[model samples]
Target: MRNVKLIIEYDGTKYNGWQRLGNTDNTIQAKLEGVLSKMTGENIEIIGSGRTDAGVHAYHQIANFKTHSMMSVYEMRDYCNQYLPQDIVVKEAVEVEERFHARYNATSKKYLYRIWTGRIPTVFHRKYTYYIPQRLNVEAMRKAASYLIGEHDFQAFSSVKSKKKSTVRKIYAIDIHKEDSELNILFHGNGFLHNMVRIIAGTLIEVGLGKMKAEEIPEILEGKIRAQAGITAPAQGLFLYEVHYGE
Candidate 1:
């Protein structure tokens, strides 16, 4: 048996997210599995690092699948790219350790949220960036993000539907890059809960807009309630930028 690891990139605008839902075939995982199963003549399953919400793009999403097929990794990559939809591409594929599991073995993940802070619409970036036609106080947003750069119980930033034993997670870094009207917020964390990053981004945006004070982040976190956090930023603005694993 061979454990094949795949690096995938996709424009998630029309898909229903990354996980495969029962009776719903519009998912990234289902799409890749269908092609791989056909190519290998065996039922195959791909374990993704995490489930990205609908309309959330990915720059380098990772997945691993085990199969008993004889096809070379290069051939599998080519075949998948040739057969998969134009919006989704298998950038790289290679064999990995037999015991490797994509989701469980992941070490860290980096997500990027793109925002357009301009009075006019960002014509070409509309699909990938959230448009807020107002000047954002970047420095204030930075102050709010500093509170999120360490281990904490992030229950308030998670979705109400998110049920986890412990909502505690560690954030290694929070980087904000501004180039003209484009603001890129990148977060490096051990793991994330449902709608966690989006909620964080929304909260920071509120601080930037003067609706929320940067000093209130700790209180919101301590509240441990969803209502205390800001809105869930639109999925289109969020991207699974990268996934890290132990070598």
Candidate 2:
């Protein structure tokens, strides 16, 4: 068997999410797998680096599959793009060592959240960004975000209810950039729990809007109560920016 790795990009507006659902074919993984199976004439199951929520977008999602087919990596990439929906594209594919598992071997993941602070939403970007008409205190948001860096149990900032899985994850950085009316928040982390980035974005937004103080972050982190955090930001505003496997 040959291990083939693929770099994928998708606009998740029409899909349920990245994971394949048994009841429906409306998912990124299902679409990719279906096309690959047909291209190679064998059952193909691709393991994604992460599961992005519905309406989230991805710029460079990584996935890999093991197959017995002798198709070239270039041909595999082209075949996938030719049959898959236009919103999803296979940017690159390469044969790799059999031990290279996409999800397990991933070193880090970066997520981006876009916020439009303009008085009126931009027509073309409306589907990709969250629009907030009022002004926000970016400095306050920055101050609050600093507290989130480093390893910590993020139970308060996620929607996941199960305590079985440890919520301890390391956030490498939280960089917020503002240009004109657009605010881009980039989060680099080892891994994230369900809805963690969205919740963090919402919490920072609240701090920016003066609804929450920057100093309250420590207490929230220690509280470990989901209700203590801000609302979960809309899925459309979030994007899986990149997956890092290290050089």
Cα RMSD for candidates in order: 1.1, 0.8
**Predicted candidate 2 versus true structure: per-residue lDDT over 159-180, tens digit per residue:** 8888799999999999999999
The window of 10 residues in a row where model 2 has the poorest summed lDDT is: 238-247
Candidate 1 wrongly placed segments (more than 4 Å): 160-164
Record all residue pairs in model 1 with backbone atoms less than 3 Å apart, i.e. clashing: none
**Which candidate ranks first by TM-score, i.e. highest?**
2
lDDT of each: 0.94, 0.95
List the candidates' TM-scores in order.
0.98, 0.98
Look at candidate 2 and tell me the lDDT of residue 139.
Answer: 97
Model 1 Cα lDDT, one tens digit per residue, 163-236: 74789999999999999889999999999999999999999999999999999999999999899889999999
Q: What is the lDDT of residue 172 in candidate 1?
A: 95
